[model samples]
Target: MMMVQPKLTVVGAGPGDPDLITLKAINVLKEADVVLYDALVNSELLRYVNPNAEQIFVGKRRGCYRYQQEQINELIVERGYSKGHVVRLKGGDPFIFGRGAEEMEYATAKGMDVAVVPGISSSLAVPAYQNIPLTKRGSSESFWVITGTTKQHKLSEDIRLAAKSNATVVILMGMGKLSQIVELFQKEEKNELPVAIIQNGTTKKEKIGIGTVDTIENIVEEQQLSNPAIIILGEVVNHRNEILQVQRNINSKLTKSA
Candidate 1:
């Protein structure tokens, strides 16, 4: 009897770009015997999986029948021990608000080998795609990333100050609490500040809703924007329109030249 090789690789799918996936992650998927992926992951990346590999949807979507964390943990453990190679794919960096750490801890406790591959976080990438630089000398100096749906269900105290400070704020998984989150910033008289809510950032499905902190709640409501979105709040949000206009002008010039 031969001892089976127990290997578990948790890979980040990046921020909605199939091409952003790491070379190591692609190789892991290509060699994996089993791949468990999340809802945010682009399915196109799965094309690299071994033809005989088993692909499972373990995504946890809000208001949907999300696979329980415990169940997912067990699935990873079971599959990892049973298969020669198992890959747990997630959107964004595995350790950044991705629960990848939790999954890794559980599997490691069971004596399984685990490795993590970093991916681009939408919190940072989304704003970049929108041309809203998180930090500019005269604009912003720092940025904060917070999850809107935390156990406390309140913006982190650090983020509360960010609302008042010059730091740009990016909230992930926050669509459902959009109104409340905006109100949190408004309570301190930061309501007049610019903000942008981008859904499906970095993808063709991207949609941007812009308004002041005071008016964003209504704008988002009127737009019916949903989750899996990145909310940017601060002066950086004020630049979105101008940046987009600049991009359009550049495109028009290229078109005319062609």
Candidate 2:
């Protein structure tokens, strides 16, 4: 009889980009006996898995949950024992509202050896990709990443405080609560604060709407943005245009010389 060595490795696939997955994560996927992936994970990364490995979609998207959290926990244990190594591939940093720590705790409590590989979080990458710095030297010395909704599906209380701070604020999965967000910021008398809503960020399908708190709601309606998007609020939002303008000026100088 063969001795079974069961293990579970939680790997972050990064934010929506196939090329963003870490080399260490790819190696882990290659050795996976079973892989459970999420909705935000780019499918192209699956190609790194061994041909004989079992691949499963355990993604939970808005309004669609193919497998609940409890079921996924059980699947990891069951597959780990049967398949040797079970890899849980999640989108973005698993610890960033991805419920990755819970999965690790469950697997560890079940007596399985657990490991984690961190990925770049969308909260930071999405805004940076658009030239919107989450933290700048003077304009924004800090930033806060807040979830759009709580476990009760209510707008997070953290938003109210974030709106009142000088730090740049990034709200994840908060598109549905745009009106509520506006109300909170307006209450802070930050009606003219710069805000940027980005959807499908860092991907070819990305769309952006930029406006002040007083006008962002209307911009969202006009752009038709929805879930899987992030909202950034702060003066740092203007840095994007400033950077672009600088680039244009350099281009003009080169054009004249040419």
Task: Pick the TM-score winner.
Answer: 2
Residue pair clashes in candidate 2:
none
lDDT of 1 by residue, 76-107 (tens): 88887777678999999988899999998998
Ten residues in a row with the worst lDDT in model 1? 153-162
- What is the number of residue pairs that collide in model 1? 0
lDDT of 2 at 4: 75
All candidates' lDDT scores? 0.85, 0.93
Clashes of each: 0, 0
Q: Could you say which candidate leads in lDDT?
A: 2
**What is the C-alpha local distance difference test score of candidate 1?**
0.85
Candidate 1 lDDT score at position 215: 86
Q: lDDT of candidate 2 vs native?
A: 0.93
lDDT for each residue of candidate 2 in 49-160, tens digit (9 for 90 to 100): 9788999999877788999899999999999888889999999999999999999999999999999999989999999899999999989999999999999999999999
